[model samples]
Target: MAASTSQHALVSAKSLCAGPSFETRTSKVGFVSVRRCCLGARKLGLVCASNSQSSVMEPAQLPLSPQSGSTPKKSSESALILIRHGESLWNEKNLFTGCVDVPLTPKGVDEAIEAGKRICNIPVDVIYTSSLIRAQMTAMLAMMQHRRKKVPIVVHSESEQSHRWSKIYSEETKKQSIPVITAWQLNERMYGELQGLNKQETADRFGKEQVHEWRRSYDIPPPNGESLEMCAERAVAYFKDQIVPQLVAGKHVMIAAHGNSLRSIIMHLDKLTSQEVISLELSTGIPMLYIFKEGKFIRRGSPAGPSEAGVYAYTRSLAQYRQKLDNMFQ
Candidate 1:
């Protein structure tokens, strides 16, 4: 969907679940282990700590449903978070990882956890990730710091049996679980022959200008590989077809993907020209936020951190949601 230019007010914040006794004010909140809560709750769960706190906030009313395929409503507003996966093993090694599926480095894990804490108070009903392990790991690790404590379960819809086998039997369990959909279309740009190659060595062999063009040019592809424009085709198409419907349905969505794929989506969201997009750079594990309302995407910039006062004040709804968290855990 194309973005709207007219000014629109942010929607009211929805009430999140009340659970856990973790310290939201501390920077160490991201490092807190939820292994016990997760193991006990199951469902690929990572739950927040629980205490004697009682619920004080009522759920926010909405004009539209948050179900998977609900129709779009102009009055509805939802949060859309885009996170580039943290540093992968190949990244640390300075290798071209494109579609190679490397795991995250230890620092990458920390980056993802930190990214989670920054947006823990924000609502996230659904998650979309790339088919790569690095992106998937980042998403799961980040959710561990969420204030809502809902379990994120990977939806296995690729095959009939896979879907049936992964189904939860209890309706209550479904309520506490967020669906994580993985799509190859959201994967990093394919590097073709450059996969597993060291960046410096490739640059030395191919010459710096040629290698730079292959990496940074908007439409020039490396030998037998995809260019930024080519990558944008599939990524933006998937975002429009699969993700926009969720936002339209009022579901809060998070996307964990690679630099190129996410840049492609951001180019679409921000309506950047091909030349502008080629120069865009996304730091690993830093999540960018956009408010989806009235079928338009409004870029709110990257959230600073959970402790930053302005982070909550980005919108009235976000501030209310944080206040509810404070009340629930106080």
Candidate 2:
């Protein structure tokens, strides 16, 4: 992690806010709302608290398997929490949201809160967010709900380097902190020419089917942007090389990024085909949890589904847009 040049500020904030931190009281309201359904057991409480502390303090380590054919050693005790960012400005504008770098709208903020409300239970130790503000905001809000604590998340140098989040977490109650990592591989799909264009207008100019293909196809890149396949190549490479190993070490991981970056990962995790992968939709702000044992991904909670009401609300919530994606399936 790169040290902040303001030796005065970083060092000062570090002193004032640092310690074995706990979630602030305000954050607890949402936490109680979501996890109240399952906290009855004393054993569960101990596991929850212990997982939180251990995941926060320890260095995650996992190695390659010793099988005849080499492969990464699979995680025995890992759970992955994948979250798409809350709705963004472009999402509400009925525009091609590819790589526009927009922040969330006011309603989007509520969606983020609702999202946090939804995933407040799992012991999420580290959060990985895209450098983009919308995703960053989503991660912060979700963590607050998850822990009910307001630990200041300072972006470390390496986190900034990869457009991924990484660094330390200091406890308000203890003298310890944990690090978060960020990477550009988590960035939204980069749309070249169609980035900010109105989806409807683009459809009219180019045949609607062609436009649909651009948005939902795995191999076809729109004028200047990357195809889903391109994004997957980069995203999965990072996941395999950097992120998966962490999960394999029995760590709980939180990934808050854009639609396509996440879809790229989903494609790898679920082993969907190129054609099939394009039809996948990750609802904004919803946390999709997957438990991994051995080398295989274990699905827990919900399967992939259509964008929720909140997601399309950002994308203008148009009937045609909804219908278009509906018809794109295999």
Q: Which one wins on lDDT?
A: 1
Clashing pairs in model 1? 13-317, 20-49, 20-50, 21-49
Model 1 CA deviation exceeding 4 Å by range: 1-73, 309-313
Let me know the TM-score candidate 1 reaches against the reference structure: 0.79
Best by TM-score: 1
Per-candidate TM vs. native? 0.79, 0.65
Residue-wise C-alpha lDDT for candidate 2, range 62-146, written one tens digit per residue: 1221221244344245557788888888898988877667889988787777777655545454677777888888887766664
- In model 1, the Cα lDDT at residue 264 comes to 90
Worst 10 residues of 1 by lDDT: 1-10
Candidate 1: tens digits of C-alpha lDDT, residues 76-172: 6788999999899999999998999899999999999989987898889888899999999999999999988889888775666775576577767
Error at 116, model 2, angstroms:
1.2
How far off is residue 46 in model 1, in Å? 33
Off by over 4 Å in 2: 1-76, 148-152, 158-178, 303-330
